[model samples]
Target chain A: MEEILSKLYYMTAFSSFTYQVAIMWFIAFLLLYLGIKKEYEPLLLVPIAFGVLLANFPGGEMGVVAAENIALEGGRYKNLFEIAHDHGIMNFLYYGLIKTGFLPPVIFMGVGALTDFGPMLRNLKLAMFGAAAQIGIFAVLLAAVLLGFTLKEAASLGIIGGADGPTAIYTTIKLAPHLLGPIAIAAYSYMALVPVIIPLVANLLMTKKEFEINMRQMDKEFPAKHTIKNIKAVKIIFPIVLGSVTAIFVPSSVPLLGMLLFGNLVKEIGVNTLRLSSAASGGIMNAATIFLGLTVGATMTSEVFLSPKTLGIIVGGFIAFAISIAGGIVAVKIYNLFAKKKINPLVGATGLSAVPMASRVANEMALKYDSTNHILQYCMASNISGVIGSAVAAGVLISFLS
Target chain B: MELFNEAVSIMIVGMLTVFFILFLIVGIGNLIIKLSNKYLPEEVVPVKATISSEPSNNTYAAIKAAIDIATKGKAQVTNITKL
Candidate 1:
């Protein structure tokens, strides 16, 4: 009977599963439910939730080993190569993609392929709103510090405000690798909630008059015809100039912004590189995102994710997102005080880097207030600029804290 | 207290850096657009010309003929070139 019991015990996951592991399994199920049923960031969340489940299962140790006993071979820092060599497939994905800091920039390259800077170029002033929205990142940083997180942890937590998932992940990995799971989850969750959160903030802040303010450039009656120059020269020159300037100013951002501009250059350089553009944006990008989501989720083992700090991260993330929207709206209001033509304050709200979602929500709110006011084009200017602004903010944090 | 002070400084510097860089891009992007618009504006393409060996059988000629009739000879097809 004892021999039979021993054999059964060896076969069962319960024999090794702790209560904390059980709780983690439940949390993973919750993430899966949110991803599949609620349809919140399903592309990322589904893989992440599955990874969490796998990580918690019996004896595989399907997670990156935490930073421990490391005799530095060079420069007093642990060698990533040594750390990566010690683990399984999940660790390979984690260290190879996340630790080496390769995946975020790769994803940014794909984003560049899909993005158009025409709207932002047309409304140059709207880009300021994108910059203003970054205030939430810093605001949350202060809040996190007040709450007792280290400066690096606070910075990582604060970046969730930018609403840019790749930047959040990249910054967190660099500054505080241990906080990567919660920070990534917070960033992506709030990003997926853009349609909900933006409107809530916009409605609370902007009056009907502000929403009714029709953006001039979008007005058909305005004869200036603020369309993007279809010249291939402009397309070729813009990315090169932007990339060069970004690299010169913020070398830290070069990895993310450089790849972004490179991908855009490849697309714009013409039909000769069309295949390359398609592959970068399609196949390679998808692969990186899958691995990124899964490994990040797997890192959220019970011991790492269930701490008191996790709650602080969640609350801090929400504050960051909310305050960023408020900052944008406030900036627009201040701009209106000085400008001849007033922009819709809701456009400022879309300054968060959630892209079309934040901009679309702004448009929806505009339409609600005045059926004729179409500010999506104007809103997109701020939306795309927010991407750049967030990258710059990440660079600043990396430069200062790291 | 030191952490608080550091966080404040980070907030100030980070926001300023982001704004400065983006503002520079905006200024440069706008300047480029304005310069391109001024120096190398898009050509004012009134109508595309159609070229065909058999002008009467071509779609352009048929459209031209329809336009001529509709306008009562007020308009004429000066050139027809294939797209």
Candidate 2:
């Protein structure tokens, strides 16, 4: 009886089953803290954290994954911490959504549903700003290649510069699934930090005169009697055309491009707002974000993040950011020359919308220059264009790399 | 020393790779547009405002419109809630 009892205890001790669940539970709490206390990208991050918590709970898909680490590299990196490259909740999320390119575009669809593209259409030059913002993507890609990342890995890392979450996640999964864990975490974290990051960079790049200079608001009257009859047709055309082009030129990017276009297709179809919004904003998008974030965060288990490779991603991302900003500024200068009226250079900053955060930052900076000066909405117009631009650049990069 | 050497190597090779790709894209994008104009169906007529009335774009327009609506003599008239 004593011997049997001892064996049972041993089996349970070796399992680490309860402990792994505890660890995931702790992670969930941390995500909640980040959401409630820190208020860091709460809408997306909170759900993500909870997903991590659930995934890690014993018998919750990730339990078996954590158990494997103890068997395999569990003892190899004794002194050093090890991030589970495979197995567990992170593994499931990665395989299901990130690898499949399922979630980000759906999230983007929701984003599209909520978005007003009016500003982007009005200022044709904001299209240039959107293009300009993509400089970071190339800059980072090159930097990654330089750091001895292969073409695919370089492409994956460089996409962080686009600062669009779904595109980065999708591209990385295609180009370098191994690096997805770090890249996704980095991409979303930087997006959350954009208000802090871009402001610092923007201020460093421009002077008070450049920032303060207010351009007169353009008279942007919505075209009267806009017909929806053909709007759906034109909308459908964008996805089909872009999707076909992407598949033909760069098949690797087809997943990202397809998902995005599908979202737009749903929007264009416009018959079922309920299903469209559900596909875009509801359970599917939310569940994926939750899964994407925690699983990504869980993947960051010490060893992976501490490497020289991570350093490469970090530095490469900033290189991308600076170059993208420079591209915007350069475009603005050239646009100013030919234009009859001088537009505010600050509008150039909205080329990357961490949603309204970057746009608002540009607006506030402008407000400081002239209290009555209001160009916040104009900056936002460019910001949305930047989101589209980032997605396109990612698609283009994936095409080239693949 | 090794890091510096690596950096120089990366810069040169990376710069070339970037331009090569960018050139191809710019070339292709323009080519497609030109080719389309030369070959494909006509009439995807975009908006017809030659000059942007204000230097700013839709962001400004939306804000200005909202403000105008907000500050109107009878601001209550533009009660958007009905929509």
Candidate 3:
């Protein structure tokens, strides 16, 4: 009877409970609440939070072991079969898909399929603000390095400023895979908070007059001399041309950018490549996101995540977010100083890779100032360019650090 | 100090490269638009003629009556022409 009781207690995980495990559980539950109750990036957060729960189940042995831990334990690297047999399925998925740095680019392909470059293509000048926003990445990199993180780790942490999850995850996977858990969480959390953050910074920097700067009125006053006659032809040609140019300059960015352009190409081809485009944006992308969220979340085991560095990352990420938004706004304000046709500072604020959310927030803010000022299209011009800009920035960081 | 220097260099190079690439895109994008406009301008779909003959007095009166009813006597049909 005594032996049986001991075995039952051991099997139930009650005997293995620790304060760290309990703390991880609390964090996981908080994320779950945020995901479900508040609808904060529910699709990703739900899976990730659930993954956290699974990883912290004490005796479950489901958490992903870091490569260094595995090497240190066994005095050598283990094969996939051995890893699966020893550590379970979570480790298998992590090492196989997430650690191999395969899923982020696949997700990027889907993003490209869903994206339309029409807005950016129409207002090409606004694309410069997208580049300006990338200043946050380097700024945070410097800060993180000063705070004692290695260059690679700092780069991973800094990329949270890009406001892109896949870009952050991809860079972290390449540079400092160990920091993947915290970096991804920070990136996605800040992205989900785009609505709150954009207004917070825009309100701080932009005046009522700047908010009321109507893009449509400006366009009527100074109409573009050259209008795209065959927009369809240009749309089809754009991905091809931009892909070649970007690849020529930043060859390291090919995996993420190349896949994105390929997906866009398939989408632009219309009915002919409809199947490929749908597959990329639908099933393939969904599956990749699930694996990515789960595997990445599983990496946030109690021992790995309960560090001073995680706190630093959380703080640094917010600074990065604020700085990126400010960089774009300041750039536009500087442009407004000289340019005859002034752009809404709100349009510049949307120059982060949070997609339609950033643009929508800017548009809503614009409408608040002037009912007739609908700047969604103009904001999209900068917002879409931001996606490309962040990816390029990620590539540069990868090339420099890794 | 070396790390700081490397970080600064990265900042300069990364920003410049991003700006340069996007600038090139803007230039090429304009070129593409110009070429397409010159060669493959949007095909103007010709509108088919709906009315080939003049309307009779009775037909014009009927149309005027319909408009007057729809507008509740607020509008008047001043002129009538046929294509």
Highest-scoring model, lDDT? 3
lDDT of 1: 0.86
Ten residues in sequence with the least summed lDDT for candidate 1 chain B: B48-57
Model 2, position A86: C-alpha lDDT score: 39
Query: Candidate 3 chain A — worst ten consecutive residues by lDDT sum?
Result: A68-77
Best by TM-score: 3
| Residue-level lDDT tens digits of model 1 in A1-402 | 999999998888768889999998898899899999999999998988888888888687686567553335554644556555556677767876788899999999999888877777767778889999999999999988988999999999999999999999999999999999888888888888988888788779888778788876335444343555646666677899999888989999999999988888888887999998998889989998899998998888888989999999999999999999999999999999987667889989989899888888888888887787888888999999999999999999999989
Poorly placed runs, candidate 2 (over 4 Å): A1-32, A47-93, A217-254, A268-274, B1-83
Q: What CAPRI class is candidate 3?
A: acceptable
Q: What are the candidates' individual DockQ scores? A: 0.47, 0.04, 0.48
Q: Report the C-alpha lDDT of model 3 over A91-140, residue by residue, as the tens digit.
A: 98998898888999999999999999899889988988988888899899
Candidate 1 has a TM-score of 0.89
The better-scoring model by DockQ among 1 and 3 is 3
- What does each candidate score in C-alpha RMSD? 6.7, 12.2, 6.8
What lDDT does the true structure give each of the candidates?
Answer: 0.86, 0.61, 0.90
